[model samples]
Target: MNMSTKPENKFSEYLGNDEQGNMRLRLGTKFAAIYVEKGKDIYKETSKGLVKVTLEELVSKPWIRENFERERAFQRSKALAVGLQSSHIPLRERRAYKKRMGWVGAH
Candidate 1:
């Protein structure tokens, strides 16, 4: 009858990157898509095709919540790295400069 069982491992499907090189998630039956709104709130595309679900609803699934936080941290790290690279100053000096400018600890 071809009845498919759920994946035991949460990360069984490696969805990989989309065309724009943004990493996508393997939402499975829990979700269809993840959307980040203003103020960093999260929304998930529900199975019934709902788009603007609450952050609480989104976080109900452990893997989805984990992935969301991981994605956010990765982006922040990338921004910091970019900022560090853009400046001609040395790494040590840049750290001090960014700290003084209130950009380092703020993010």
Candidate 2:
């Protein structure tokens, strides 16, 4: 897996571009993610067969990003609390908290 494109640790979105209409994914973004809980195996069998998947997979047309929008969103969230905090608040709250935290581009 490419080190830069890999998820923070684990956990992925399994998504694709909105217009591509990838039947295998759910996200409108080009980036994707995959992860299992701290316990239990990440893989399980289903009608789709052995269910072989990985965190390295990009389900979209492959955003091919270097400091792409996904990273921008990540940075913006990091600059915000609701976005990066464990509280799971909405985007607005996160943005406000970012401003409070003095993140320059939080808006």
Say which candidate scores most in TM-score. Answer: 1
| Runs off by more than 4 Å, candidate 2 | 1-87, 105-107
Candidate 2: minimum summed lDDT over ten consecutive residues — where?
A: 35-44
lDDT of 2 by residue, 25-85 (tens): 2222343332222122232235564354344543342442222345446645766754356
Which predicted model would earn the best lDDT? 1
Give model 2's TM-score versus the native structure: 0.20
The CA lDDT at 81 in model 1 is 92
Tell me each candidate's TM-score. 0.44, 0.20
Off by over 4 Å in 1: 1-41, 46-49, 52-60, 95-107
User: Per-residue lDDT tens digits of candidate 1, residues 2-102?
Assistant: 64565643442435545655444555545445443333444444566535546577558566657656766787798899997887889888779789999
